[model samples]
Target chain A: MTVKLYDLAHSRAGDKGNTLTLSLIPYNADDYELLRVRVTAEAVRHHLRDIVAGEVTRYELPNLPALQFVCQQALTGGVTTSLTMDTHGKSLSYALLEMKIER
Target chain B: MNERIRIGCGAGFSGDRLEPALVLLQQANLDYLVLECLAERTIALAQKRKRQNPPLGYDPLLERRIELLLPDLIARNVRLITNMGAANPLAAAEKICGIARRLNLSITVAAITGDDVFHLLSGDEKALETGQPLTASGPLVSANAYLGADAILPALATKANIIITGRVADPSLFLTPLMHEFGWLPDNADQMGQGTVIGHLLECAGQLTGGYFADPGMDVPGRKNVPDLAHLGHPFADILPDGTATFGKVAGTGGLLTLATAKEQLLYEVMDPSRYLTPDVVADFTQVRLEEVGPNQVRVSGGRGQAAPGTLKVSVGYDAGFVGEGEISYAGSKAVGRAQLAGAIIQERLRDRFPDLRVDYIGSTSVHRTSFGEYPDPYEIRLRVAGKASTASMAALVGEEVEALYTNGPAGGGGARKYVHELVGIVSTLMDRRTITPQLTLFQS
Candidate 1:
């Protein structure tokens, strides 16, 4: 069954320079491996391509059943220079949650 | 000394609520309360203020926060540590001592300086990412390196009631007490890394305690309950001699602490799990474990570390021109269409002046950006356009275009707001740690 990533996991977004780091953690411990397999870096890059201008790299942590994706060149000059209201990219984690995943 | 020490966070940022911190001081038995109020560009702003007036660079809320919590802190004998001094630690310390004197409280406040490397830095220093020299990145305002806990230890050893600092690493505020209490060596990477992890978790205050963790039905485990964020409780950590820590909040406080929240905060802003660099230690968060030992209490352990970075990260702020923004609301029938039309009108009108002007439909794709595809026409939509330019007048053009849309473009548009402000751009660079010498100044009241 298809479900939104929000239904499977919760995440937080933080930024450094032009990079945005989003940490995606599953609701259930059992769903970690499934998410690890389905939510590839390319998949996330494709999902957020409209906003992010650069590459995406994913790091896995089985201990916490979490995936941290670093989106490079994501912020349009980051907090001090970005023209957008959400300069910190604090709301971008919701974008990651909006991605669809197979349940 | 206690085998386990309790460290509480009073304020997460400069503007965080004071009541929660007061509640923490009155309720929780803590050895230290650290307030992390400085951000990447805060010191730059403070420096600008200090230039305007030599003795006015500290946080605006310094007096109010100290007034509210001073008597309680004095009576309870809990030490206070903060980077709230911003650009002027000496001035902040004097103000704090003055406050204590007025209250007839005997307290020793120490100011830790030397984070400011503005005079020591040269214009030829290259940025870490852009490889462009600092001279090319506009006129420099301020440059402060992220000092480690070592800079704070000497002041802590003096047994001061309050320690004020400027531009120290966020985690160093919390780690300094741990090091002072446990007599941990400066090169004890494993312990420093563990302490950094604890600092990182509590650094955000209520974030791990459900302030930012609650998402209604989405947050896992026990966080689904609606949080009373208005009375959100601050966070505290109980650290043992072996680098293990347990995070919790005061009982009956308005937040929840779970393994899920801990895990989320554990990775907050972390770029690499194996190499989380700070001025003190290169922490490894990969092996860290989180276990809910009890309700609203999570035990975290297993943080590994390697040698600290030879070079320190310096946040250099410079002039980045100006930004202008304007927003107008469209509602009722065809609200989305009206907002889109309004956006089109601004884009067309300001094409020449603001070639890079960006428009966003706040009610629809402004945040997630079409990841969920189109939504049904909303009851209301806010159309926002923003752009950057070299001068205030040029930046004002972007907002002016949006205001013109009231009569020139879409129908049912109302409540227009426009703003323009100067921008301070920040860039990161590396400097040799040995050159920067941190000093401590002690004051008594």
Candidate 2:
């Protein structure tokens, strides 16, 4: 069965310079392994291809059962010089969550 | 000294609420209150304000905050640490002392200066990311190093009623007190790591207490109907000498401080949990555990880390250019079509002047940039156009062209608003930690 990433996980985003950091934690702890298996750096880059211009690095924390993605060139420019209404890219987490995933 | 130091973060950012902070002060019975009111771009903007008026570089809200909190703060005896000083800590400290004097209270305030290392920056220093020279953007306005708890400890040792600093790490403002209260040397990596975890979790103030965690779902319950959001109390932590910390909000105050909220805030802005770099320690956030001990109470512990980085991050601000923005609302039938046509017309009209002009349909395809495939049609859409230009007048062209859509191109466009702002650009670089020195100044009322 297919499901929206939002159904399985919750996330928040933060920015520093041109990079955006998004941390995703599953609502159900048992789904951590499934998310880790499916949500790859390449998959995320493909999912957020419109927003992320450069590299997207993913880090895993088994203890917290969370996945953190650091996407470079994600902010267009940093807070100082971005033309977007959401200058800090606070809405990027929802954008990432909009992606579809197979359950 | 107490076995556990109680600390509360009053303000998350510069413009955060005042009521919640008063709640923490009056009810939480905190030993220390930290207000992290500075962002990367704030100091650069504050530097310009200081240049215009020498004694006016501090946060404009400094007087109001101190004035509002001074009497209560003195009566409660909770020491305050804040980076609300922005570009000028000395002036901010004097301003707080002045506020204390006006409140008919006796207090000592200490200001930590020397974060502004603009003079030390050579023109050729490259930004940390692209390795491109920072001055390549434009002439430098301000460059401040991210000072750590070390910069603040000397001032914290003075037992001042308030301590103000400029351009320190948000976590450092909280960590300094822990270091001072616990007498933990900066070299104590484990304690520094554990304390940094607590600081990071609490740094965003209300975010730790469910201000930003409001999505109620089938799986995640009891979040959407966060009771009395208007009175949502901020958070405080009680950390023991053993490195375990329990976070809770004031009893009877609105907002939840459950494990879910703590888990969300645990990794809010952090990138690599294993190598979370700060001036003090390379904090390992990966091992930290968040468990709900009781209602609105979460126990946090088991954090680890390594040594501090030899280099400190420097936020360099330069005049990038200006950004002009215009937004107009379209309503009723065929609104999306009119907004689409409006966008095309402005894009074509400003093609020569603003080659990189951006158009966004607010009700639909605004934030995500692309709508995956095709999004649902909307009954109304707000058309926004924006672009960057070398000069303010040049940037103003974007908004002006968008407003021209009222009669020139599209039909039924209303509620148009235009803005032109000189954009402040911030880039990061690293400097040898040994080169930067933090100095402290004291003011008494």
Candidate 3:
């Protein structure tokens, strides 16, 4: 069955300079391998093309069963200089959650 | 039973609530309390103030925080480690000593300085952004290096009841107490890694407790949500000599401590899970494990590391000129069309002068530009217009233009507001650790 990523996983967003990093974790740790294959860096780059201006790189944490995504040029010009209302891109994680993947 | 050091974090940032910290200090039976009050741009902004008016660059909230916590710290004999010093550690330390005297208490305070390297910059150093010279950012306001736990070692050795610092890494404040209490050598990679992991966990204080966790009650099935955040208490750790620790908060407090929260926090603001670099050590969080031993109790283990990095990261703040903004509220029928028309007018009016002007629809597309699912039009919409310019007067035009919308006939635009303020730009660079020296100045009441 197919379900929204938000139903299968939860995420958090963080920033350093113009780079925005988001952590994606499955609600069930046992769903790690299944979600890992479905949520690819290429898929996220395509998913967030409207917001992300640069490349997206994914790193895996097997122990925590979480995925960390490093998105480039995401904040426009960092916090103090960004023109966006969401300066830190805090809600970008929710945007990622909108993706639909295999359950 | 293994000897354990009890540590708690009071303030995660400069303007955090005093109540949660008070709760931790009074009830947690903590041996040490850390208040991480410095952000990336805080010290840079503070340094700018110090240059304009000497000795006035410390944290504005430092006095109130110290005034409230000093007695408890002295009475409970709980040592304080904080980076509230901002740009001037010595001045901050002196101010704390003054407060202690007025409170009729005898306490030793020390300040860790030398994070400011603005005067030492050659101007030819490359900025981390575009490989351009650091001076390209214009007359820089401040440049302070992110100091490691080693920089704080001398202050801890002074046996001071309170240690104030400027521009130290957030995790270093929590890591120093562990280093001192356990006699963990600076070069002990494994031990330093473990301490750093715990430090990272507890550094944000309330974040570990559900301050930033996702909300509950979504239509999506099966999300175990965070509860009792209204009176949420900060997190504290019971650390063993071998770098093992059990993290928990005060009993009868609001908040949940579970494997889910820990997993989310484990990668919060983290770019790489394995190579988590800090000034203290090259912490590796990949092998780390978390287990909920009991209700509101989680045991965190398996944090490893390598040698510390050779260079220290520096936050350089520069004057980014001024930003002028204006907001107008539109309610009732046809609010959406009116707000969009107002935004278009403002954008058109300033198109020649401020090409980078921005307009946002507050009630609708302000936060997320694209909606995930289906959504209906709202009854109310607030239109916001903002633009940046080199001069304050130039920036103010953005607000004036927006305010003119009322008379200019956007039709029923109410509650108009206008404002203009200066802005700061931040960039980072790296300097050899050997070049920067940390010095501790002592004070007594």
Candidate 4:
């Protein structure tokens, strides 16, 4: 089954004003080649409380083949229920009901 | 349905010591029972079991323990679950079923599987270690993916008397069954947050709500009683329907579960608070708020969270450096302070002897003392030195300093000591967004 789950705040917002940022690199590039993608100020405003701004100014690295979303904040419990929260900090009960998991 | 349900966890870090935490559950009078014991090294031990002629996995310690307590739990009708099935959960089910038949107890044993992702990486063994597109390891000893609570939900639905799993997320032990009974699901982040809070509070048994809290007014012992020799208390948490949870020790148990104690356990072995990722959920520790609601009860709530990514990251530690620990005490005027100085001296000597050696201390003396960064300590200092590098003989070198403490320091009676040898390995693993899909399994025995 296919369901749409929200990517983490910064991941969905992309690189912009928010502290969380994403980077891209050539498939065969070394770890150092990782390049940061700059998000628009508008995108930053969208992810303010969700994340903080990085100290250094970052360059935007666009995706050529496919758009990638990198979650800066942690999330888990794809589906479970509990008065207890999962390790990722999200509650399984809320996550399962809200998360559209095709099973 | 909204009424409070008391869940008791069985099995602890140690099985040979402390009167078996499982037995205490009977006296505590709990509603549900959980047994937890899954460590990185335990996986290696489970591998050894699978390598045997019969290919048996880890022992069914919980099932055996349950055999003794089955009458009590059945009398009270306490449903139970555990992650004791380290590698071969199917085999574990067979053992549990054997015991159930002997006792004539109608027990529904559910085995949750499919999280053994390591086996899938066999053809491409290298991809398993680095988790990189392509990389490898020395040998495929053992591999078990950390499953989430949702996987256990199906098992709980079977109306099983006991749910057994392998390498489930730590908090999932407490969260899954609670969710199954309450009918809560993914959309319940707030409730999940509450459950996460409960798991965090009870993660270390009695640490929260008073086991570790040194409340002077409570007449509790210092470090000696942290793992109390006398009657250890069974800690309980009361979770409200409104997404708040309160925790404390079982009435007359020895330890205390105060705010201080609870806070200490919250930060244990944790790397980040914002995305407190467990095998089950990504709990936010940044906004967690704890208050001493009563003498021994701490109300824990207010842990906000973000949506988890579609992928789950795995960590595998590889060869990195050597870690050796040696302790020498100076029993003079500035005993503690001098021990600290000697620790520094030995560290410096090791570093000087092998400039590349990375040295550091553990226990109360180190910065990374507690599991998480939640608690602070004002205790006497204990020193440990770690060396990381290709050229560092950390173990043999550190051993020399342990011998030097008596002669180098002021006339403090320093004696010979032994060093625990530990190998430092680099933990590296990756998350496959595609493989991140959640699975639910329920088996009948």
True-contact fraction in model 3 equals 0.69
Which residues of candidate 1, in runs, are more than 4 Å off? B217-223
Model 2 lDDT tens row, B119-214: 999869888866889888788899999999999999877869999999998888888888888788888898889989999998999998888877
Candidate 1 residue-wise lDDT at A32: 93
- lDDT per residue as tens, model 4, A1-103: 4331221111111111111223222222121122122233343323322222223223322212112223333221011110011222321111211222222
TM-score of 4: 0.60
TM-score of chain A of 1: 0.98
Could you tell me how far off, in angstroms, the CA of residue B282 lies in candidate 4 after the best superposition? Answer: 3.0
Best by TM-score: 2
Give per-residue CA lDDT, model 4, range B284-386, as digits (tens).
Answer: 7656677768776777777655554455544332233344445554453555566667766776677765454333233332321222222354333344444
Q: What is the TM-score of chain B alone in each candidate?
A: 0.96, 0.98, 0.97, 0.70
- Candidate 3 local lDDT, B1-445, one digit each (tens): 3389999998998889888888899999999999988888777778888989997899989999999999999999999999999999999999999999999999999999989998878778899986898879776888999999999988888879999999998888988988888889989998888898999999888888877884676775436566678898899999999889999999988887788878877788888777888998899999998999998899999999999999999888888889999999999998999999999888878899998888989988777666644567789999988889999999999889888998994899999999998888888899999999988889998
What interface RMSD does each of the candidate structures achieve?
1.8, 1.7, 1.3, 19.4
What's the C-alpha lDDT at position B407 in model 3? Answer: 97
Task: Sort every candidate by DockQ, greatest first.
Answer: 3, 2, 1, 4
DockQ of each: 0.69, 0.71, 0.75, 0.02
* CA displacement after TM-score superposition, residue B152 of candidate 2 (Å): 0.6
Q: Report the CA-based lDDT of candidate 2 relative to the real structure.
A: 0.88
User: How far off is residue B59 in model 2, in Å?
Assistant: 1.2
Give candidate 4 misplaced runs (Cα > 4 Å). A1-103, B11-24, B53-55, B59-64, B122-140, B212-229, B315-428, B433-445
